[model samples]
Structures are given as structure tokens and as C-alpha cells.
Target: MTVIKNAELTAGNSFTQNQALGLLTELVPVSLNNINGREIQTTSAKKLHAYLGVGRDFSNWIKGRIEEYGFIYEQDYINFDSPNLANQSTESVQIKQWKTKRGGDRRSKDYCISLGMAKELAMVERNEQGRAVRRYFIQCEERLQHIAPQDVRKLRDQLKARITAANDFKPMCAALELARAEQGKLTQAHHYTSESNMIARLVLGGLTAKRWATGNGISGDPRNSMSADQLKHLSYLEQSNITLIELGWDYHQRKTELTRLSQRHLAKQLEVAND
Candidate 1:
């Protein structure tokens, strides 16, 4: 992608993983092809030290830089607790970890740097690598600027999906209202609301819809806060509840049946996630 003109430097500090790798390769000849994802850049501390030309005292220097720049661990850089040993030959693993050291038993796997941390390092370290990093970041920022329109479109599509999910919940609410009207009881109305809360908790990972929305930094009805997959799960439960009510099941029977099924389904999902 061609770089856009007049892009802001500050905007370069939030690159996706692909963008970071592209820029890194442009600056240096090293290949960091082992990592996966859109938000992480993993390389050895030794590699970073060599590139920065900071000599053999890189451990202390990096520690000092992190403190001086107020870098947040995991956000700016992740010092992995366990070394990544997946798919490595025995000799290569030994060679890779030969000069790497850590404070405790944890071997140095790699330093996972975010775009923000990389930008700070480029600015703080005055050397050839620093200049190259600065130029690469500028180009990356310019390319991101060119994709602004696509980002806006993606956001709009997401908002539309959220709205559709919110609308889907209205039928369930209406069906419960009808059940209350047929029984002509205030208790039935309250029971349906309680049951809805239970279902929300089951499918939405333990929070009531409103609480989930607030916790996720969203506003408005929590039902609208669900992803498409979550909406599908909730819709299935709601439709089952509506079907049971239509077949003349009382509130107590519907509650007992739905509660048992929801709990079992949630358990299965949890089991799969753990595996």
C-alpha cells in the first residue's frame, strides 16, 4: 500500500500486527514470522538490543527505558511467563535460548512489543536503528490514513448488526407480555422478567444484559450489546420459552424446564472452552 501524505505521527502508534511486521522489515533485514494475530510483535530482547546498538548491558537499559517511558506491561510489552517451545527443533531451541536470561526460572521467550512501545523506543534511542524506525513508522501511519474510509464503513456495518440484534429481542419481550396478559396476573409478568434475566446470564457469560453493557463500556439496552453469536444463542432460548408458553405451560413449568436446559448448555460450552 502507498503511504498517504501529511499523516500525523501520533497516529502510527496503534498499528495492527501485520502493519508492525511490514514496518519492521522495511527498517531491518530480520524476519519475525513466528507470531500470529493483529496486535503483537514478538522478537528476542537480544535482537532488539542488537538493532538498537545498546551493547551488552541491554537488560538494565531496557528496564530503565521501561521505567523512564512508563510502559505498561502486557499493554506495551509482554515478557512471557513461559518460553514458547512449540514446533522448535531441540538444537534450535538451545541456540535461541543460549544467551537469553531472565530473573527467575522463566527463560526469555521473546519480548512482545506493541506499536505504541515500538514508537517510544524509536524516539528515545538515538541511533541508526532509531532513525530507520522513525521513517518506517511514518510510512505505516500514512498507509493507515489511507484506510480510514474502510474503517468507518466497518464501524457502520457493526452498528447496523447491533441494531438488528436489539430488534430481535423485542419479539421475546412481546411474547412474555402476551403470556402475562393471558394469565391476567402481575406475578406472571414479574416471573417472565426474572426468567429473561436468567436466560441473559446463561448465554451472555454471567452478567445481566444491562450490567454486561455497562461493563463492556457500552450504553443503552444490554440486549443490543450482544455479538451475533450471542444473539443466536439467546434467540434460541427465547423461542423455546415462547413455544412452551404457547403449548399452555405454566410459569413454574417453563421456568424449571428452561433453567435446567440453560444450565446444562452453559456447562457444555464451558467444557469446550476449557478443552
Candidate 2:
């Protein structure tokens, strides 16, 4: 039999876990663990035990619960004691060695129970903390269920298509600007170059497209490296520039208007995110 040392199991600190925690209730932190190429929502058994204020030793309590409920290994929970941990990333399962009462280092037996197992365990406890945590788990499940992974992927693909379509209009607008310059006898090769630089500067914080690509070590357009939000904002600015060009606004006038528009759009975005 393996001796279960009294040590706290560290919660996952990965970005996915942190982001989920921020969105869900933080009463009991959860993690997304990769098992056999699939991600599972799990929580630390030790943390759950501590949160429940159980009177029995953690090892005995967990073992008794598993045996009593007939919880299957690797299906309901995962034990970190196995040598298989060598194949996993540290971020996936955070395990740490601790000093024992005898001043010796030992790795504790840590278990990560699935959300289903966790809810069942909490329900069996029949206490206020258990009830509260069970409800929290239910809420987390409902929220996650609303945004399935496939749905998110589909939405992202749609956004990419929209951005690409928006990009195609920019060149057409540039040709319109060239024609307008010719009619006004202000035709200059540098006009098109300056207009492109202005859009890059407005969207990328003063970095020209070439400068941004070089700075990020990108071989092509820097838009490919931009976040979804940045790309959407870039699309909006491009359309705005196209309109200003049609309205016969000079380069300096359009630059001033675009700067103000970008600032206002960013402020609105921040406000909406906060709300």
C-alpha cells in the first residue's frame, strides 16, 4: 500500500485554467486536464477535501469514498502517483515534493477528480459547503455547454472570412482615390503609399506594415499575426478610411479623424468588456 503524505495539491496554473476560473465562480478552482488526447474538467481532490472541512484524513476519506461508490479509476479520477506522469507536461498536472515531519522529501499522492465525480462527492457530503459547491459546478457546466468547442471554431472561421472580404475592398478604394487625385490634378505616386502607411499607423500604433512585419519576425503581412480583435478593428478602420477617401478628405484630415475614431472605438470596446 502506498503511504499518502499530508501535502496540499497545487491547482493548475495554465492559461486555460486561469481563464475558466475568471469566468466561472472561484469557490473551488477547476482545471482542464488532457487525458488520452481529450481535455477533461477536473478539480483537486485535496482542495475539495479541505474546502468541505472533512474530519477524516484525506487519504482514508478519498479511498473510502471511491470504494464505497465504486468509482472507476481513470474514468472518474486520475492518480498522479503513476510513472505515466513523466509523459505529461508540468502545466497539465502540477506536482510538487514536500518535506515530511522527519525532514525528508516525499511526493504526495494527488488525485484529480472529474466534475461528475466531484459533484457526486459533494452531494454525498450533505452539508452547506457541499450544496454550494455542487450548485457552482452545475453553473459551470451550463455555461460551458452553451459555447461548444465546435461552435466556437465555426464562429472563428466566419470571422476570418469576413475579414478577408473586408481586405479586398481596400484596394478598390485605393483605385478610387487614385482616380479622384487625377481629376483634382493632385495625382502623385507617394499619395497611395502615404495612405497605406496612415492606415498601418492608425491600426498598429504608428508601425508601418513593413516595420511591423520586421519587428514581429513575420515573413508576410502582419495582419496574419494579429489577434481577432485587432483584425476586426483593422477592418473597421480600413472601411472608415475608404469612406474618407470618397468624401475627398485630404491625407492629414483623414489621419486626424481616424486617430480620434480609433481611440473612441477602443474605449467602447473596453467598456463593453468590463460590463
Candidate 3:
């Protein structure tokens, strides 16, 4: 049995590119609303409640999850008054009620969470409906971004850019440095580094960063001396390892999964690259 070091599975957002594609297949077009003067896509708590088939008292459930997960109020969700309310006094007041259905009850204030937060909430919800809702959120993201998976290079570049923009290269460098810190650590704890090299060989024309840099006569920190293409492949490996770690995969399990994913990605890239 593989022993997961940090098995707090609740930490990961649990979203993936393949799952995002699956979500895109099930999407229904809806007009996205604006938030704070920016056009944004969001799903209401009421809609999610109905979709999830949770009981009518979903407000309590939503509140529970929001508080439990420490989801930021303005960032993850927002409460606002309904403009369609009949009472002028009520209209002026910030009411946060949602109708259970289209014409159901407007008993309380309505809460709206971003699609991303919805996916995270769904991961913890652990029900079939919750899974479906998570897919919907991924679909929302795909549609919003206009993702085209057929273009492998384009997609890889986009993911690489997004990961790079969101995270400092320090994490990637740190992971590499940690891998080289000790041979035992590399072979045992950081086995994913080996799989990463395997993936890099296929995608980068049979060359890992260190090997490539050495062959080209570059000295010191092959990671720092990587070409753009080599860096992108390294980024993908780093992301794979990070995702596995976040999902609470044990060291060995992560290595196995990383190997499989890297091989799969390499195959896909080959198909597209050859086309």
C-alpha cells in the first residue's frame, strides 16, 4: 500500500484539464453576470442547490461549507439584493434571498459563488450531483476561456503561461533542487523526477534539461540554463507533481501516476506534432 505523506485530500481544488473538457461537453449557454463592474461568470447557490438535489435548506449547507472551507466572501461568493423584488423598501435593503426554482420562494438573500469555488466546494460535497456540478464549473471555465484542446502546442503553451504567471519559478527550481539534494531522496521520495525526465525525452526530442545543457557545454544549474521548450516541459512536470501532491497521493503513487500522465501527454503531443 502506498503511504501518502500529507493525506489531507481536502486541500486540492481537484480540477483537471481532461475533466474540464468533459464539462465543456455538458455546458448549456447562459448569460454570465457582471460583478464589481467586471463581466464575470458565476452560479447562484439556489441553482446549485437545485442541481445538486440537496434539501430545500441549502442556504444552511452553503453557509456551512463556506465557513468550513474558509472561502473568501467577496472573492469566492457574493450576496446581493434582487432587483426584481416587488417591495421598494426591500429593494433598497441588501436582500440575499434566492427562489428555490424559477418561480419558487424568494425567502432569503441569494448567494453567488464563482465557478472555481463551486468546483472546490463540490470536491468536498462528495456526491454524484456534486460531481456533476464540478463538471459544470469546469465547463464554465472552458467556455469562458474558449479552450481548444485539438491544438496541442497552443494548449500546452497556454497552460505553461498560466502556470508561470500564477507561480514563481522558485517552486519549480526548489523542486528540482530538492530532487538533486540526495540520490536516495530522488530515487525514493521524489521518484516523479524520473518520470519527468521520461516525459521530457519524448516531448523535447530525447533530452532532459541537465543532459541537454551538459551536451551543449553549459555549466551550473541546468534548470536555469534550460531553453524555452525545455522549460515548458519542466513546467508541465512540475505541475503534474504539484497536482499529485495536492491530491494527497503518496510518494510512490504519485510517481506511478506521474509516469502514466507524462507518457499519455507525450503520446498526445506526438500525435499533434506529427499532424
User: In lDDT terms, which candidate is top?
Assistant: 2
List the global CA lDDT of all models: 0.58, 0.67, 0.56
Give residue 91's error in model 2 in angstroms.
Answer: 49
- For residues 23-70, write the lDDT of model 3, one tens digit per residue: 433332233664432245677665566555555366588888888889
Q: In lDDT terms, how accurate is model 2?
A: 0.67
Best by TM-score: 2
Compute the lDDT of residue 100 as modeled in candidate 3. 38
lDDT winner, 1 or 3 = 1
Report the lDDT of model 1 for residue 147. Answer: 56
Against the true structure, what is every candidate's RMSD? Answer: 14.2, 16.9, 17.3
- Candidate 2: regions farther than 4 A off: 1-172, 175-189
C-alpha positional error of residue 9 in candidate 1 after TM-score superposition, expressed in Å = 32
- Please provide, for model 2 over 133-176, each residue's C-alpha lDDT reduced to its tens digit, 9 standing for 90 to 100: 67768766666667576644544654594576367556645665
lDDT of 1 at 148: 71
